[model samples]
Target: MTIPPGPYSPNPAPLLARALRALRRDTGLPVAFGGPVSRDGRGFVIEQLDGARTTSLLRLRVQAGAGLGGRALALARPWVVDDYFAAEEITHVYDHAVAPEHLRSIAAAPVVVDGAPRAVLYVASRSSVDFGDRLLESVARVVQLVERDLAVEEEGRRRLAAAPPALHSAEVHELVAELSQIAATVQDEGIRRRLVDVCRRTRLLAGRVPSADRSPAPAVAAVRLSPREREVLAEVARGCTNDEVAEALGLLPNTVKSYLKSAMRKLGATNRVQAVNLARAAGALD
Candidate 1:
């Protein structure tokens, strides 16, 4: 789900940093570094560096088709160099940075999401080391996680862009309800989860929308729903059955029923519809 060029640009820094940490911990790699591709898609800057002794690799920019990472980006695959300085297969444009880092063996894994390269992850060693297929596969697995997370984040952004500016409007509520139903039918679990998250956020946005004509409802201000309760109620507001809510939230049906009953009790509602309406009026589902 690609979105048109806009002021909002996707920043994969947090995801990249988290994945790199996991990679280093799981693989025991000495050095790991990478960054998200530039908005223009020309190149990426090294924004994350783990276990790196020198700051040389940090903030270093790599162009497409220029270095090991660049080759990975261009080819849309993983690449490894046993000897960084002697690798003839890749163009050595960042030799200055690599030399100071004392990194000999380096592997680059490109994280491509939705047909676009979102970021590149690199694991390197001080001494020349031959990276095996197993090691490369491990890197690939981490890259796939990053790709999946980016896809989910991108979908959330796309839905947000498609949502009306005035989320408190009746039309927006109807739209979010329809989207929630559509999310249930999607086969991709990651995408479906993101769509459901988008619906929750849309309802929250509605509660936060400013209006001069509106006054805060006292009932909304007094009721407090726990985070889990809010989550279950948000799904219920979308008209999901207890079974459907359990499936969407990875909770048991009994747990879902318990949460609904608790929320209904707090809101003085006799049924699911009334509970949702009361929650909305109270700003609990807003």
Candidate 2:
């Protein structure tokens, strides 16, 4: 029997690279490297290197439970050694690769999602040094960002796979609603903006069907909506009640109503349904 690869094989290299950069910025580490777990569940091949003295560490496959990185992958936590070669707790299989770089201190943190390690991030220093709480916390924050991004990307891929090529209006609305919920939970500004873009694309995808025979959408005066107002209306367009919209967007029902009213006033809509139709016509909701 053969074991399959880890779920996170071929990890998003760009995301890992960004996180590594963040690690270096926050902790001022001399070198940083990382990669996603391999497809065969064996280990990760180092695909990124930052500030390294040599390329010897690049593309090196660190097996699970063997070296500093591997042990972090196996345990789903961070491990740091002040003296890499002298660290007896970990195996020295990678000393041949590590020693050439003159690295004496190293740390590894696993990017875990839903209890499983998906990738590993490593930082090292040429001089022996102990990592303190502040540095470790910084590393943790960067890893958490990567974990959230990976989870978001994974969910997006799954939904895209399940969606029909031409989504029905109802399906699109559901997708928009789910994306909105996900966007609300995201703390990273960049990731949140990307999610918003995905929501816009989903709406555009639903609007792609041929409409040559249908009457032109009614003319609605151009109007700009505040982000909160637009968010509330987007949920309303999905047939969500004010309370439901509030819950989804993490707002009070009264606040939701205020935003809805403000948007309706701007769109000159007589009611909630009219506001949604007008906003859709004006290309604001999409």
Model 2 / residue 11 / CA error / Å: 5.0
- Each model's TM-score? 0.67, 0.71
- Going through the candidates in the order shown, the clash numbers are 3, 1
**Considering every candidate listed, which one attains the maximal lDDT?**
2
> Following a full C-alpha superposition, what root-mean-square deviation does model 2 have from the true structure?
7.3
Q: How good is model 1 by TM-score? A: 0.67
Model 1: residues with Cα > 4 Å off, grouped in runs = 1-8, 166-201, 204-286
Candidate 2 segments exceeding 4 Å error: 1-11, 164-166, 187-197, 208-264, 267-281, 284-286
For candidate 1, the 10 contiguous residues with the lowest summed lDDT are 1-10
Whole-model Cα lDDT of every candidate shown, in order: 0.76, 0.78
Worst ten in a row by lDDT for model 2: 1-10
> Quick one: best TM-score, which candidate?
2
